[model samples]
Target: MTNWYKSWEEFHTSLSKHQNQTHQLFRLRSSTSVSQRNKQEVHVYAWMTSQESGQGPANDFVQQVDTTRGSISRFGTKNVGTHNHSLGRRQFDNHPSNRRIDEPGLVELVRDLSSACSKAKLIMQHLRLKSGQYAQKQSLYVYAPIIAHTQSYLILGKQATLRDVHNLVAKLKAMRNGSASVEERLKARLREFCTQSGNTATVFIDDAKTAQTITLQSQQMRRFFKAFPEVMLVDATHNTNDAMFKLFSFMVHDVYRHGQYVQHSLMENESEECLRDAISAFKEFNPTWEETKVIIIGKDFGELALLEREFSQAKSFVPFSCKKKYLRTEMTKREYGGTNSLNTKRAEDSIDMMLKATTLDEYTIGLKCLFYLLDNVKLRAEDPVPHPKHTFLQYFMRNWGSCRQLWAAFGRAGIPHLGNNRRARDFMGYLKDILKSTMGLDECVDTLIFLQSVLRT
Candidate 1:
């Protein structure tokens, strides 16, 4: 039976009446939703249980269907193990059986006599790795709670040390199946994304001989794209998974006037063809893409060139970091690679002026500094040894210098200095911390979607 009450008093009275009449025990828990903006939501969960007067911690539970050898067993703790001595129960209440500070590994003769391998193997999850436990005392510097855990779950005597359990884990791993697969799993997850996002989510996964591309977007992402189609930032991160896949993200400014990266794609490489597939999918989803300004704040100018060719209508943005790197590299070579002449001295000081330029007036002064350093007459009589010249500067002036409107903030009237797509990098770090390890393709997508939903709600 279920009922909804408007007031807490009313609900409490009704719940008390049921408890008095049925004499059933119940537990109360809450789920909290906290936003990055510090907004909070709390949901109260109160339910009945058949465990009245149970002799254990209220939340500590072991889901055991049977004592079968290979049956699934879960020793779950509600909140990372809280201590409640008055209740005579605690989470993970396992203590080492050995009283000594040092113990030797089992000899071959003793190992032959031991027969608790199956029971011990049932406890450890990670391959040959023991769980880090809190040490309780100084005398038992070498004692492990994992041995106690194995004993509690399998009801075994003191027959296996930590090493014995690890050996068993290694043995079982050799006989186990290969790494888990994920194609079908990701497809199922994408289906769920579509439902949760009211069919606004878009997903496309294709496997080719040379490349694999998986693109995903949620309602929030689409909404951002629809609203702010004027500016788009594209970037890719490498070594994000075991398959050596690169994760790419597309971002736009949100209504709050903040950067919101709204899409993720896994690709085999940052090649033009691979990136084109991902960008075209997003471009097709939103009709206003042609009005958008595309920024490629990633490595590889070839990728940027491909984007320029693919979306010629959108204005391109070159990140300030790349501009600084090019300026510093070529100018430093001119300053230090040649003699201590007046030209080299002037070049050394000019590099400082260009880097610190802020406004249009200041930027012009910096350009004058570069012009002086780039003058071929100033760098005359270069050393016999390898030295800096105007070659790198000349190439840049003929090609990139003409595109100041794309790379220089001073050229854009109202636009602030859009340094790099750092928000995407920060969000990626948060996701990595959440998973704490390299996750499968399906699992990674599912986790990101869940995080998006949390932020949305």
Candidate 2:
């Protein structure tokens, strides 16, 4: 079982003889060796089989060696041939338990009881309080161990922590959601919708890495477009889904003067190509898309241009409300000092007044007033220096001045826009109430279809 040497010379001779001949002797770390109360050193050493000695011991092996009196140390050797030393106590200690649930049956029972609850700590508390109730219903043998474990770790302060319960609950949730990817689930829901109704939906995969876009329109959407193809409002909302894709909503006015969503597309980005793909889907699903006479959009010039090119007969207009919002955003810049400057306020008022001009002549006069207010800033007697609104003035003249008719009232005076962008803005508020930022893509699709059904009512 064990080999003992009497003399230090005999132990050294055996250690030297066993080095490469039959076995290997290795000294354990000093921490493994302890001194007794009398101050006698008890060294720890390891002796491994010659076959595994060249590769070193697979695990730590400690043996109490008697170093008292130059007598040889008591050496203990494990038979590597008969028994495997690979699986030591450290192997069990190093096991991965991040996703492991110690009480899986308890987790499942709790999950079944509390499907709506998400807080792991609360669920644990409920379980601890009502363990007797569950034990009465289910097997007492099965729950007794659970109750004991819970009391030991949670109440009595043992090895387990609260984080352990949270991790186990998270693992349970992951398993409950199934193994399908989010995109696959989204596509499955779309396919199920198309099969249930005579609707159409298509997904455009840009590439493996880049985000994708899904364009969908129901049967009622087609009828809405055909009934009222004169005007349309195009806008986008973000953070509606976990994928961070922008949900582009194309709405139109119904007979009741209600803004109804006619088409929707979840896009990766609002690039021209992505918009074109969405519009192409719209045109394919609704033949009356080309009959749109008026389009109201945001401050995206590229989107405006694309809409013009796609619907050549349609006139696109960015309403005054949107223009005011854009201007106010620009006016808040630190570079322009602030909007309280006389020149900045005058310029803003003049622009607002200019956008309301009904005739070209009136617009021309309003433009002159705007320039005069910007150029002739009445400086206080204390400071005679020119106003620092040159940056804002230049920005306005370069961007807003160059595209006057697009945002001005006279641009689409001949066309009917109903309430212009008021209906669209209201719809955005409605969308915020229904959708959430943490929703998955499949959940977003389901919510969108539900909203469409509600609007149809």
Scored by lDDT, the top model is: 2
lDDT tens digits, residue span 1-457, model 2: 7999999799778887776464455773444434452244212223344335665554434445456654544444544556443444333333354222344455676677434433556665555545444445554443122335645532211122356656665566567669988777787899898995669988887657554678889889888889999999988888887788788989888888888888899998888888998988888878777788888887754577788889998887887887887887787778776756546566678777778877766666666665456666553434333433467777877887777777777766676877467788799888876676656778788889988888777
- The ten-residue window of minimal lDDT in model 1 covers 40-49
lDDT of 1 by residue, 1-457 (tens): 6688999999888887776566555786666545522432221111222244453347666687666676777787665566543221121233333321122232222233222223334443221132222132223343333335645531222333456555644444333323534666666777876776333444444554333777777767778788887777776666556566677888876767677766788777777767877888777676777776555464344576777777887666666666666555654455434343336456545544544455656655655555555543332233221232556556556766566666656555465435565665576676655542245566566666777778767
Q: Output the lDDT of residue 144, model 1.
A: 34
Candidate 2 similarity to native, TM-score? 0.62
TM-score for each model: 0.52, 0.62
Best by TM-score: 2
- What C-alpha lDDT, on a 0 to 100 scale, does residue 95 get in candidate 1? 34
For residue 441, give model 1's deviation from the true position in Å: 1.9
lDDT of each: 0.56, 0.70
**Deviating ranges (above 4 Å) for candidate 1:** 1-180, 199-211, 294-296, 299-301, 325-368, 371-403, 414-420, 431-437
* Stretches > 4 Å off in candidate 2: 1-173, 207-211, 343-345, 377-389
